[model samples]
Target: MRFTTPLSAITLMVASVKAAENPIIGLVDRITSISQDFDNALEDPNPVRIIETLPHLAYDGANLVATIVSDVTGWKNPLDNDDQLKTCATLKKFATTEEKLLTAILNDVVKVATLPLPIGGLIGLVASALKEAVDGIFGFSVKIAPVCSDAANKDKAALTDLIANIKTAI
Candidate 1:
């Protein structure tokens, strides 16, 4: 009886770990997809349009993150049963937190992309500067491959491929 109880407990623990990993994997996949979309947008001929769309994209990203957090954290307010008030409260909270993070990251990307190049010789230097600026703004190291380089030469296509790869990884 004792041996059976211990074995059942170990099985339950393993199942819980697997369940926890699914949400984490989903979050990582969503972030990677959003990153790739942003990168592809950067490569568009009308980058200004892409920049203008950042807020909407950021909001969507934030919503996804908040939903994931709510699921993982099992957050429930007593008012949650009241549909309208619950949604408004949740949105307010999410906007103040996850939305802010998403907006910051998006704004950082825009700032980096808008930096002026001083001279012809400093193109690569500018890209490096942009990378560092993004890192600083996001408080995380953002790996931005040069658009002209072999690794990321086909910018939009490469980003698409990368998104697929990241999704597969997750």
Candidate 2:
């Protein structure tokens, strides 16, 4: 009975530790999933499918970015090397997806523009809005890449200044 009690307690402790995962990793993963969805939508040949996917992607992607940035600002502990690399890799994937999405949207705009004025115009507006959102996210990823990569390797001054600038911007 005594041995069984200790084993059960250890099991509970392990479960609790696993449950308390790093929030940033989860946020990055979610954003990455959104990014992949954007990629898949762009890859689809059906224009309707692409259009249908845009609103959800825009809303979710923007919110996720905001959430991640907010969480990062609040984080006090420095990430270990493994986590730092994982985060940077995911961010790179996200930026790449955004870049691809922007290019695809531009191509789609050219294709859709030949339609009659009203429908074409509406699509153009949606495309523009999506592009704007992608631009914001892409620009953020580009700006942060260096800072994120240098997180563990570099001195604190650069990262500190970046956080201060972000807080001011927010």
lDDT of 2 by residue, 1-170 (tens): 01112443454355346424533334434433554454455456777766666566666655655654565456556556665565566555545544454445445445544543233433433333333433333333334343474432332233223323322321
Instruction: Pick out the ten consecutive residues of candidate 2 with the lowest summed lDDT.
Output: 161-170
TM-score for candidate 1, residues paired by index: 0.33
Model 2 scores a TM of: 0.43
**Candidate 1 lDDT tens digits, 44-156:** 55646554544444554555455554553452322223433333332233224433333343444445445452222222222232232222222110111112123222222
Clash number for every model? 0, 0
Report the number of the highest-TM-score candidate: 2
After superposition, the stretches of candidate 2 with alpha carbons farther than 4 Å from their true spots are: 1-25, 32-53, 117-170
